[model samples]
Target: MKISELYVYPIKSLRPTKITEGKLTKLGFRYDRRFMLLKVIPGENENGSGPTLKNMHIPEYPEMGLFQTEIEEAKGESEGDTSRLIVTYNPPSSSDTKDNTESSDSEDSQARRLEIPLEPETATLKPFTVTMHSSPTTGYDMGSRYNDWFSACFGYPVVLAYLGTNTRSVLGTLAPAKRNNESWWRIWKQELVLPSNGHGNKMLNQWLVPFSLGYLVLNAVSWCHGRIENGTSSPAVAIGVTALALTVLWTVVNILVNRRHEARIGFADCAPFLVISQTSVDDVSGRLDGGVEVDLTKFRPNVVVEGAEVAFEEDFWAELAVGSNGNAGAGKDSKVKLLLTGNCVRCQSLNVDFSTGKMGTGEAGSVLKKLMKDRRVDRGARFSPVFGRYSFLGGEGIGERIRVGDEVVVLRKGEEYTVTGKSASEAWNVILTTGY
Candidate 1:
């Protein structure tokens, strides 16, 4: 198959920016999901009166899709000159509105533009923590000025946060567990230290196992002494021993199941890359009433390939090599190789009609409903219909550049290859045996 399109979302849940070519980084495209918007409760604070920050998305705020983003390179000839991300607010005209009402004249008087430094001065920005899908990572607050812009657009309190130099790990269970020739024991040992880039807090993650093991040993010794001296086990001691044993067991299991998947992500929801076949989009469109052609942008794929002979054939692709030649045996020499980690789960965001800033009631809005009828195929995320495949950049292609029209080679395919939320060992084995 050949790649037909590529896209990146600088800010999570906002409009996607299509690119003719993109650089592969550990965290997807270079600028993909490097910033995000967080909803702030008016009277809330971190002291626990209420939530201080919450994630915003198109499902809750359909107008988010109307916010267009453009990247402008710096023109100044100075070392301090930096590119800027320009965001503009453009509401639909009266004819495009679902309610047939014109946008407010005042709101439309001028298209408001918010300019943000593509690479902000993180040293001066305040550190912030943002969580998604229970995975928390560090972010830098863009201060009151940027917050005010988003807050005014939504008519509520919100804050814009930059990912800065920090990196978030892929959901542990979804990450690949093994390297090409590494053993499980080696991976377990490596897990004791920080995986991915060293941006993760060492005190919080790296030392967890040592402290837990120490505590378990101390508790065991105390319980043994108490039993020997008293010649009887007290109820409290018995309970303590049971709890400690369970804790240690859980810790070890977590190290095995979660820690080995060391893939890092930025603000993107899951893997670094998401790919979909154009034929699959066409198939979904054909199923829609009146054959309404669904916009490929709605799926939000980082890579779109067009030469698949069958719809949904990507479901069987365990690994892919993207380069000038479509050869599965290209091995590490391939410029842009990808590991297909899992299926991309769908959400109600697909029903959003950007033109009207509301969920469409016609064929477009029913995309999710149609897929749910037969596309609930992934056992791991069964409730959500599968659309695209989530992927990670292969070790060989980390710094490579991938462009549109590149040949995509299916390196491996099998029925047992899909991620089912079980242990990652099976997936790792597939990667190793297939020479990924």
Candidate 2:
């Protein structure tokens, strides 16, 4: 099978973009999760040591987004090649990665950090202020697949995408049998409250023999029926009436079993793959000093490789790393572990703004929890449609953000897996084996 889509998110809680191809490294996407929002009033963890300002970048700060970010030491440096961890936020702090930094770059960024005085970011970045930096490739597709879409659609950044091939099968298998047993009634207060399943039928067709051919045949059949009944009666009308009438009586049963399909690998010819972060001599300081947020609406992620894609993230989050393979953390393997399972339907009640990146009230989150009482999605945790910083799947601490130059490989089923960024070791740590 070939990777068909990729996504990434730039801001901590903004919308996401879709991308066709991307560069992969151990930390994750090159530009993914570069900035994040730190809720200063955190209800539960607010009082915990007051979050010592060091080593952390808080979105609440105003002047933080003043510079650009990149990973100078991400990969490909020879013995004499100079590659240092570099962050160039303000112009003055900008320099070659070969320089001996640490105190130098910080001092420079701090000096030029005075533009947005009214904002949280400041000139000194004192009181333990932290900064974030990332590679340019990281910003590739930080829009299309993020939770911000849902926020605009429903006032919460909730988005979900499935290998149309995979989700359709899962829903078909689960829907037909369940619907036949009146399962829709269980999910909703009444069967009448359900939204009409239009495109949903498009999915069930995938479960049939020769899905592509079946869909073609279905279309052909609809055409012929209408042609024959033209002038006298519209067969399209007849079929539509029939389908509705049938639904009222016998609920269609789901008989498909062990459905399987693979995406054509030809789509990705000059594409990128999930990478390994084994190259230890890195330019860690290359990314921290970036400013200015782009309108993610410009990017789209349709072709993703391994597990890392730009413009993919949930609301209120930046990076998400599922395993320690080539996608996140450190790894020498060519494979990647997914930070999340199936697409997460977000809590609109927990909706976070897309353009402004403002988080909504806690009550919205509560509403989401109530709505998820029976669904497979996680209720207590937050999630984004695209990939990002805080991984909600692990319930807050599930996973950390993924960045560029991270390594990863294709995910397979029934194989031993190790999640990235976390210390847990077990077969279950495998995010998802089969698309099902």
Candidate 3:
């Protein structure tokens, strides 16, 4: 397959900016999802302490897709002059015939534009914290002027925060906690011990402590029973047995959930790279009622490839290399190599039509519903439909550049097994065993 298109989202949830070439980094493209919008809740604080900054996305606010973004290069050859990120918002024209009397020139005058340096002065910006997918990370506030401009566009209070040198690990990528000058007991309580499933370790620590107390009480009762009648039937004995069983179960569950990897990411959702094929999109369009071709923008894929013989063939791709010539064996020395991690899951945001900046009404808006019938294929993310593949930089291709029309070589192809399936686990055992 050949690389057909490349894009970068300077701001999350906004329209993507197409590019001819892009520099690959640990966090996908050079300027992808480094900035995001957060809703500022007035007279409220998160956890009754810090600033109330809630994440905003296209799913919650469909009109956010209406905003357009562009990157303007620096003109002068000076160290102080940096490239600027330009964002523009054009209000939709009125649909009523009476309200359509406004001239096109007059409507253009109503458009709003905002520009800020792509690389901001981090020393002068204020440090701010915001939560994405329940994980809190640090960012720099872009001041009140930029905040006011975004607030006016949305007709509500919101702020733009930039991820400046702050990193958020992908889920299941955290290294084991180390005892660096910390107390032994503290480490045991926080890291060594396990909590129940679907709950934070710290939040469930309180309950575990009581189980420790039960252990002591059981020891005392056993001693008394041996000294008196040597009987095993006692209320304390029953409670101790139950507590011991539960503690063992919790430990097993924690071990299964705490699997880790070595990948890192920015504001992008699950992985650094999202890859999709043009043939797969064409297949989805054909399934629709009128065979209306849907725009790829709705999927928001960073890389688009063509020449796939079959639709959805990306589901079996494990490793890919981009270079001047498409050769799987030579991918180790290629310009860029990618490790396909998992299937990219879908959400309700796919129903939004960017052309009108609103939720679709006909078959276009019901894309998610149609995919649900047959595309809910990934066992790992069973509830969501699988579209593109999530990937990360691997091999010796870091800091390399990839361009459109580059040759894409598939180094490895996985078996026909869904993610989280037994066969899939066996197929990926090599990568997992090597901790790639």
Candidate 4:
């Protein structure tokens, strides 16, 4: 198997920016969701009276899928630390009514392009806070011009926010639990922080919560040195050597597992990257009304693989490695390593048509129902049908570029490995032990 397609979404919930060669970062694919839209909750604020912000992703507003965005990075660094992001709003017009296609000459003409600075000056802007999943992080208000642009487009009181800092950290459950109890739980120091997307299951949250006693005691020494949050009593747990070691191990595993992808993420729902087999998509499409032709982009995967022998065959891949140009590298430069985190559970977002911005298409639950006939692997999300595996790129090839046609190698196969969601620590062990 090989990578058949690669994509990046510069902004969350908007259109995908397709690219053959992609660079991986600690947060995610470079510029993939560094910016996001938020629904301005009407209330009182610092400006005497203003609105608070809450995340409005594809879940809350499907119309966001209608907007297309392109990032034009400056050719040289001397031009200043900024890039131009062009956003094109695809409004529903009589011309778009004829077909369900995403782009056309008519729509292109009608599409309004809004050019915004990549690195906007936040010196005069107020520090706006928003919650992603459930993690609270601060973002700079992009001014009224941006707010007006998105508000007019999405037909709501929306504000654009940029990730000024890597505020929110990846969930402990998504990545492996840190070893030797070094308090590797949070990246941000907030009073009452929660895991993103309500991943706080009763079992896992007990050990992973930022303020839990187990965490406090493990790094008691660091907290005593005055590492507390906002100068509050809650001290910041100093990251330990064990935590760094685990990270290094995770990176090494990612490099050897699949050299095509490295460990990096930026605001993606679950993991840094998601991979789906093209054959699986073909299977789902074949069953959908025979001629409806549901595009794979609806699934919003970073990487899509073609030529799998059977549908959902990717489930057995524990540690996957992919080589460039069908040529395998000897030490580490040859391939990209990817560690299978868990199965991606589908949500209502899949039902919305990316091209039409309409919901409840005939193909919405049709493919899911067919997949549920046998392909349910995640016991925690048993009611949901899974179509792709959410994975993390290992650290060794952190910024390596991988493209379509990279040869895929399944370095480890774990037929018995499954994400039970009963406990993250237990699940991590299962993923670690079942692989080669």
Each model's number of backbone clashes? 0, 108, 0, 24
Runs with alpha carbons beyond 4 Å of true place in candidate 4: 44-50, 78-82, 95-111, 121-125, 177-266, 326-335, 423-436
Error of 1 at 384 (Å): 2.2
TM-scores for the candidates: 0.74, 0.25, 0.72, 0.70
Cα distance off (Å), candidate 1, residue 360:
1.0
- Runs in model 2 deviating more than 4 A are 1-4, 37-350, 353-373, 376-411, 414-436
lDDT of 4 by residue, 347-378 (tens): 66667766667665566636546666766667
RMSD per model, one decimal: 10.7, 23.7, 13.8, 13.1
Query: What is the overall TM-score of model 4 with all chains considered together?
Result: 0.70
Q: lDDT for model 4, on a 0 to 1 scale? A: 0.64
Minimal lDDT window, size 10, model 3: 173-182
> What's the residue-level lDDT of 192 in candidate 3?
38
Q: Rank the candidates by lDDT, best first.
A: 1, 3, 4, 2
